[model samples]
Target: MTTRTSRRAGGRQARQALRAAPLAKETRPVRAGLEGGAYKPLTQAGMERIHQAALDALEQIGLADAPQSGIEIMTRAGAILGDDGRLRFPRALVEDMLAKAAKNITLHGRDPQHDMNLSGTRVHYGTAGAAVHMVDVDGREYRDSTVQDLHDAARIADQLDNIHFLQRPMVCRDIPDNRDMDLNSIYACVAGTTKHIGTSFTEPDFVDDGIELLHMMAGGEDKWRARPFVSNSNCFVVPPMKFATESCEVMEKVIAAGMPVLLLSAGMSTATAPPTLAGTIVQAVAECLAGVVYVNAIKPGHPAIFGTWPFVVDLRSGAMSGGSGEQALLAAGCSQMHQFYGLPGGAASGFSDAKLPDMQAGWEQMCSNVMAGLSGLNMVYEAAGMHASLLGFCHESLILGDDIIGQALRCVRGIEVTEDAVDLDLMRSVCLGGPGHYLGEDQTLSLMQTEYVYPTLGDRTSPKEWAEVGKPDLVQAAKTRKETILAETSRAHLDPIVDQAIRARFNIHLPR
Candidate 1:
């Protein structure tokens, strides 16, 4: 009688327990700020050797084309202006600047929830590039990427759980004027997503105008300065150790205006940089070190990302092989170098060597993505939807890439060997006395959502079940997801008054 009563009461007790089992947080299975650094392509001695080489290069070879203002600033910061017009950083100067640089930085999102804490080996992967063409998957053709295409990409990226931030991924070909293009690009990105945005200015004067626009959106100059939602992707140096003078000016203005800057030093192997990977690394590092000295000379401890992006190319065809094994190693190697300096840094990864999102694209996209994460790249750019050696963007591919990055981040998360996680009780409950299967066990049910990651669109059904589901096309599925996301009102929508004021002031290209 007692046993029967207990069983009857068991239903009520289980119902209460089910109601009390907390639901999962809205956070994605694979999330931003996951710790990486598991894979080290370079040994300790190797990293140190590269370090000295970079230092020696900065001290001996130096860099050329410093604007007069830059020359003054660097000279003030103990960097010697050599007789050859090269700005030579003494080893002491670079080390001093490194010590003065900001370590952890917050890449703010308008929605505070989306801000990125960039410190140490914690990793975040997102999209970025200057692709000019859009791959029309259905039509099987390439066309100029318009302002509309760019806005659409940001909106889609905003909804992807694994995509952490929005970096201006494509050039707005429809807008012709330089100033107009700069303002519109920033506007389109801010209007689309509240996530931390990365954009570029054509020249230094453009930065002043862009900052004014940001002031309007931020309600005042102080507010904008207090929390800069966007960063300037300034390519301060040309390859092989030289400054792009105008971009250096732009970097100064961006820093002065209290905005963060990604000191991007992208060098191509067998092309703009040295042919050997180690040699390429040295050049890239030396250039970015010069950038650090440049930035610190402008303002001490200002937020900056050491963007040491080194790329590999196929030596024979003279074409970029962004998806090649060499490219993956180059990116991963850069990641290790970033950790060595303890600087907040980023590198390029997740590019497709294919013209379209094919099987080749899949392999190419994953190679660097996995390596970049495992090597602990702080901010992994171009980790999704970049194609044709960074010349094209595809909305469908961007959506699909979200699933791909989810798996990569899971690898970065690695395994947790906690007491409960490695429980002998869990094994015995099923094998010894109880159910003989883990399906009905309490631990199995409890750990399901927390321990395992399930892909949203990846099919897990049996062959017959998949057939019954009408054998749905994957690309079509991605297209449907995009349509659904764009159909909704953006979660990061700006205030109506602010939106109206912006439109009234600037020539808004994206229609309401």
Candidate 2:
């Protein structure tokens, strides 16, 4: 017989269970930390303006070379399509889709054993896609990355608790062929570890191969569909507005096959789109929406994440500056747009053009990541250890980034409400000098673990104690932590037969 548990009863039972267990007091209560910094929450008025502007661009300027089928769909749905291929969407349709899209999605990581809950108050951290640096075990730097470098990067990501997902190819690893190499790298990482993976396959065959591997790993097509055993395909929409044929194909295959897709359109202000930040964001949004519509059209109710990496062009030189204020604003705006569409948003943050891990890197990473988190983005790419303008990755940066993400996450945690948290009776008792000392209180001991987050890197000791231990900086502590975690942690195990099948398909030898 099935038993029913009321919500209140369930909570009461959990609290009672906790109270019955022996309490061990070790860590201090976690401090209330900062929320996302410098990000102005988008107002309803501002969002309305953006929506109108996007419609104007679609109707007046019109998008170029969007698939005719997409245009036909929009046109039939009351969008005005110009003879020249520009189409204007009614504000109502845009709002309708926004309301219908799914805002919350759970990304299942490599360890089927572990999953990150993304909706509501929970925040997850992970690195951005496409880092080009190579760092050895001893923290020495190499100029570029190889296939082995990708493997090592996967291993590092697998060990990091803060990192909840993997974006494929950690670097452009070489195999005899790029297509075969793409599939091999994805298989190696997915099989070697258990983390949700994000991959963008340029070729159709590779997409099929990746999907096949996911089905095998997930046990079957049905199970794979339920929890997304494979990676989400990230497609770049041609911006200041359009979707390329290949990207369209990739999106179609991924969405139709029941895999999640992240549609990203990055536009450089004054270069790709208009010089104005607002204009660029509108254009970027339209471009991303166009891609989203395509996916939705192929398979209605397909899971898709709408996103952008819009940044300002260094007007003086035409380079993309990772640290631009415009980028932070775009991240925030994109989050709002995703909310508008009722879909989760992804954006690049925690990255800088700085050559090393220094003040510039810290500030740039902090500002962008905090903005993304505060705006309530679903998945943030480039959350850790990117430098040299996102073309490089450093082991030290990864260590440092863990702390930064921790701080950002702490900000989004909002506030918790419970009877014990309110503690009105306890407060009244203290007011009467009835065991006013919190140090000896049963409540303090009971709630500490639930309320606190112990840091692996930040220094919390006294100056004398810190000096006595070793006056190591945050980076040093992080390095030590990285080593310890890597050493003790085991790679997620895979079935021997499945591993063999993957190896035989790819013609690569599995490590004994």
Candidate 3:
């Protein structure tokens, strides 16, 4: 009896030790660039039809209101500037430009370790949106989001292993000037995280200031150009096939500055686009294809993400239905279209119509995020913290999203079948003559950490244990974690000298 008890104690200690050990970067079960093409929502024929429809829309319908510069650039590259003031793309010209477009591009981060290889079906999830309200979970209230809130979100995302990139998630509502707001937004993101960032410019004139700020942060202009840690999330096209003229100009300047661009086409279905899901996809694809021609015309093979972001709307009230099942299908279908063209692509997901992070929010966010990862989206934007149809962002919800995304990435990782994984020697030993269970087996302990994923904030305790621990609420736990993270000093900021120089040169509104 003594010997048996000793053996049990030793096995328990070994299991505890294995669980406590930290996993190496390479050994983590889920990571940034896991491949995920296992959930194609469109058949080959359906995708082909969508592609042909997009081409038809571009060729037959065309898009209007291009700035004179864009008209000149595209016309020089074989686009037809119609007398109707629309720019039409020939199928052949589009094919040629598509040939010149860059593929398998890398989105560099300030820290090289965070670089994301956006090629094939590799998946990376991050935050993106222009929410004006910050969800105060404790007070159950909504307030305007400030630059400080943006920085705090970035700092929180920096500590999360699952959030691979940090895009400007909220507007600096406190800053009234558009140019200052633009500059401060970029500064806040870079200061809070070393990950690759995406931001937008209110006007084409502000692109120069944003570039200067990036150059200072990167140590020099040449260094910034080489890596270009930031990308412009340009909404170059207005819905239902028209150019956002100023935004198009911003795209040109951003590309010239050696920064990448996300050619975002966000059309609200049934309002700016067709009500049918397939029709919305077609319109978004067509608009982005026109954007592709415009971009490759400016600079052949310049890095651009084909951002076809079509949002859903509830017809009864004409409200955006960000958390609906239809929205998930829209994002997945758009991802498939990007795969069809062999270009890096992104789409919006993980939004919630609920005002708070409740049960409804949980299901809505998880369903779309899982589908987005499984559909092989290169960059999954707005994958966390968005609430109230994307009008609000919650820091606590963002922290909870890290745990949710971890699980989604595990699904993206899927199952691996190999000789060792399937070999039944250990199983046979346990079943036939050993302990009659695999709990204490050497193989069990070895594979435990590698073969499975554990959530940092999600609970998996038994009812008795959970009750014994005073029944901790998930939202409360997330709020506590958020507070702890923000209270801790962060090392993600820039060098003191460079920061001072930037502050002097620009009217940075954020506090030191």
Candidate 4:
């Protein structure tokens, strides 16, 4: 009887020790900058064929609607501006600019700890989208997003371990002035998080105004240029081989100011672009290549993100299917092409077709996210909290997406086949010795936080435990997490003096 009692007491001690095991963030299993590229959806020959096709499209079909400045830049860089107004790029010029394109780039965060190195298949996932409406998880309704909503989203993203950076995810509809909207968007994101930010300018002049504020935040023009935190997510092309004149002007200004530019070419297949997936990839690459020529012409070697974001269309409805399998394929395939060029690139993923955060959203969000990460995408944009085909942003969904991305990043990290991992001493000990289980074993305790991942808001309880805990709703849990984060979150990633000065000069919307 004493022997049995001693065994039971030992079991209690083991359970208490397991419960006390540390799971510190610094020792977590997965993290940003994990090398992905394990999943290659396209063959070398296929990538080459696509590349040649893109080059052929650029050389033969060319692009239309170049601003006079674009024409001047391209013409000086071996491009032919025909009488028909199509600015045609020579194969030589495209190839030359490709060589000049910045391959390895560092995306700076105001807090240096969060900086990401963009090269090879090093993958990082973050938020992006111009979602106009905020998904109200509680009310199950949508509302026009305000600047406060954008600021809160950034605050929540700041705390999410998996969300590596911040991009303008929603529009601040309340700010009517285009200039204020541009500057305030930067202020809101900067104030909310020190993570690398991506934002846009509606006008060229707005880019100047926004940069002035960014310079202030960075302490001066030189410091801001040395490590610009915000990259311009400029949609420089209007698909179908047409340059958006105003957007191209903004890109030029963004480049001149030393801000990284995402050469975004958003074309929807079966509508603006060709129907076939290959054709869509071809067009998107061709457009981004043209952007490269334009940028290199202005400056010999400038930082630019090869953003070939093409959305798949639901033919039956003639609407963009951002969460469709086809969209996933397009993003993954484009990532392969980025590797082909040996340049830093971005493509869209982590979007859901569902209007709400349901099972449908779960499947849709994970599908593209895993595929994009495994394909070795350098920057996975719009990888969280976007819904309704990119028209709505949900804060609760964003909170839950942190959990999803954690799992996805784990997939990117894959299995580390170290000799220690393969050693079976622990296995033999567990099978042969004391408790006949590995629970609380030395190796198990040691590897707990390093070899495994735990979700922040996701529940993994058994049915009995779930019931014991009141069977908490996952969505409600996410909402509660959101509230908790916002209540304790800081928008003071920026220095108080700098933030105060920004608010003093600009129409800063978010309150203290």
Error of 3 at 228 (Å): 0.9
Candidate that scores best on lDDT: 3
Model 1 poorest ten-residue lDDT run: 19-28
lDDT of each: 0.88, 0.66, 0.94, 0.89
- Determine which window of 10 residues in candidate 4 has minimal summed lDDT: 433-442
List ranges where model 2 is wrong by over 4 Å: 1-40, 66-104, 110-113, 116-122, 135-142, 417-437, 488-490, 509-512
Candidate 2, residues 1-512, lDDT tens digits: the string is 12223433554566667655644422222221222323446677887787778866655665666555556655665567667666655566565555555556666765554565455323445665666665443544557766555555566777665666666535654555767666666766665457777777767557787788778777888888888855555654667666565666666677767887777777778888888777877888777766555555455556676767677778778877877666877777777766665566677776787777778988998888777777776667888877777777776677777677766665565466866688688788766855444543557656645565556677789999989987877766666766674565347656878777767766552353
Instruction: Please write out the lDDT profile of model 1 over residues 221-327, one tens digit for every residue.
Output: 99988889999998999988899999999998989899999999999998999999998998999999999999988899999999999898898898899999888
Across 1-512, the per-residue lDDT of candidate 3 in tens digits comes to 67557767777898899888888878899999999989998999999999999999999999999999999999999999888998999999999988998888999999999999999999999999999999999899999999999999999999999999998999999999999999999999999999999999999999999999999999999999889999999999999799999999999999999999999999999999998999999999999999989999999999999999999999999999999999999999999998999999999999899999999999999999999999999999999999999899999999999989999999999999999989989888877876676776777788888889888889899999999999999999999998899998765888999999999999998889
* Descending-lDDT candidate ranking: 3, 4, 1, 2
Per-residue error for 508 in candidate 3, Å, reads: 1.4
Per-residue lDDT value at 219 in model 3: 93
- How well does each candidate superpose onto the true structure, as a TM-score? 0.95, 0.82, 0.99, 0.96
Colliding residue pairs in candidate 2 = 62-86, 98-341, 109-195, 109-196, 110-194, 110-195, 110-196, 111-194, 128-382, 353-389
Cα TM-score of candidate 1: 0.95
> lDDT score, residue 46, model 1?
91
lDDT for residue 204 in candidate 4, whole number 0-100: 90
- Order by TM-score, highest first: 3, 4, 1, 2
